[model samples]
Target: MKDLSTFFVKDNLDEIVFSNRNKAYGAYALRNEYSSQLTKALFVGVAFFASVAVIPLIVSAFSSDVITDKGHDYGPYILDPVEEIPEIVKVTPASSVPVKVKTVESTIFTPVRDVKKNKPLPTEDDKKDAALSSETSAGEDTKLIVAPPAIKVGPPTVAPPYTPPAKVEDPNIVVDGTKVDVAADFKGGINAFREKVAQNFDTESVDKTGMVSGVITFVVEKDGSISNLKVTGSSSEFNSEAERTVKAIKTKWTPAQLKGKAVRSSFRMPISMKIE
Candidate 1:
């Protein structure tokens, strides 16, 4: 009994130590085996893909061949030697056409007479006979008559010469107040005529837009009326209105005065139109 129990090792401790060592060794061996297998599979896959990629290129490098004389033995060939072509001879057909031309007959004509030749002239004896006949015919003429000369007349009388009056400078000739006509002494009364024009204007179409300006020249008589109405200038759009307005004025005008007497005179009027 001295030591049967001591000689018997502890069963649980021995089993625990053996189990841990076995587990560690088995895990390490499994990891080494998996690594070796994975490396081998990767090498095999890469070698297979590389061989597959190079196979077509290697085959293409040796497949192409250029043949010259032996190319015709195959089915069909292109760009063959030019000396093998056969020569072609051209044969022209003989022409069988016959040439034909039309012929026309000619006719000759002759003139009845030759007018260019010269003829003989009358002699001196024939001229002497003709002169004697003319003298005998002149001796049988009728009698002639003559008239006497008339008397001359004297120069006619002349009328008296006309004299033009002296020119006068009048202050009233310039347009001012009620003076609507140009006087004889006035050079140009455009400003005076314009004043009268303002009083004579009449609006026809007030609805119409824009405006028109026109100048009219006419003769003014003894009475206060207008005549010979004519539009000298006007806008194209208002030409009809200008003519109508001028013609509507009275035919008699208060004449311009010179030296305290009414006299015939010329006047001009300018018309303006304004629309609202």
Candidate 2:
């Protein structure tokens, strides 16, 4: 009891507050009690700083810089000894390589001039001479000269002396008319021919009909005289009358001419017996 009472009776303010020991034991004691916590906080800060510095190094070491899910999917791993990859080399073949071209000397093109109307073309002799000169300059192949085929000279045949065709009496001169420049004419014209025919018919007393009709055929000779008096018609009496009438014409006719020369020309006369 005595000890407990004495222990409770504490020292006064002068003894506790005004002590000579400057150190605050309360603060030192408080610090000592939380020392383990302080050491734990300090260790945490040091570990955080180390991770901040080393995390970037670790990320950079693993980063291939590929920016995609593919990069994220790749897990970190120890790298093998890094070696620089050699660049790919393309090899071109000798055939495909371009070659330096060589310049060639060639003749310039020349247009052919138009030939003038007054200028004549080169003759065969001139053409041969030019060809020979070109061949000599160009060292062309030897030319083969082919001789022309021989020309056989034949004698001109002499035509036999031209003999004119013989003049034969034209039996048709009394029938078919001849084409002449000047046609035959009566001595006094066509009226005279009819007058002579009428005069001869008036002398004929033989019986006749108005229906009786015939033609008298004759050829005027080159001498302007009538010949080959023939009769042609349906009625024989009328034919006979026409023939007698034509023969009665004593006047000579004007002969026809073929190319200014007199030619034998045929003549015809129709006769009708008028029975009034």
Candidate 3:
């Protein structure tokens, strides 16, 4: 309750507020020195900022001459005038002259006459030489003559006529069904043969347990007779019965043909049966 009616005071707030209170506390001392401490901090901060901004510019100014002098300078050069070289000339040699060849001389001999034949009147030159004697070493003076062409005579040419080859037949050779032009067939078709096989098969001789299967193979001869009967099966008894069944069929087969001739061909059949 001191005179709070007044708005201004000559004493600072810290001096007055803490005068009667405990000034021994650190808060009172810190409050009293705040203005001076803040002023000192502001001046130190401004000096540090100014040095950061200006130090680089001052160093660059001082070192500019050293940077310029570090590099070497090249002066303008003087070039000598160039002389033009002359072209070289080539020389050619003259050709040599050709030598001439000489010809040899020949002597001609006189001809001899046959005195036994009728003699024609001789000229004065011949008569004078003739009196020299036919015994004189001489030959007949004949001019060069061309002989007539020879005629060639021969027998007329005759070509022999062509004969066709005969067809060879070998009935002993048996060919596969696939190689023949027409495959062999049963008298009443394949199904009829299968039915005949079923009727003729004797099941009593074979084990009827589970499933039994077999393949029967035979060769149908050129004369439509079945030979070389063979059977393959899971059971030996069934195989034997199947072979016997096929052989029982006596009906002749229309034999397979090759080039319109009957040929022996192999045939295969698969037979299977199941009994509980």
Highest lDDT among the candidates is held by which one? Answer: 3
Tens digit of lDDT per residue, candidate 3, span 1-276?
Answer: 545633245235567788788888998878767878999999999999999999999998888653454555677678998888888777778787888899799999999887696667556765443434554444564444669898778997798888889877677787887888999999889999999998888888886687888888899997898999999988999999888888877889999988898888999888888745
Q: How well does each candidate superpose onto the true structure, as a TM-score?
A: 0.25, 0.37, 0.41
Per-residue lDDT, model 2, residue 215, is 73
Report each candidate's C-alpha RMSD, comma-separated, in the order given.
Answer: 21.3, 47.2, 17.3
Error at 265, model 3, angstroms: 2.1
Q: How many backbone clashes does candidate 3 have?
A: 2
Which segments of candidate 2 are over 4 A away from where they belong?
Answer: 1-178
> What C-alpha lDDT values do all the predictions have?
0.57, 0.70, 0.82
Question: TM-score of predicted model 1?
Answer: 0.25
Clashing pairs in 3: 111-139, 111-140
Pairs of colliding residues, candidate 2: none
Position 267, candidate 3: lDDT: 91
Q: 215 in model 1: Cα distance from truth in Å? A: 1.3
For model 2 the TM-score comes to 0.37
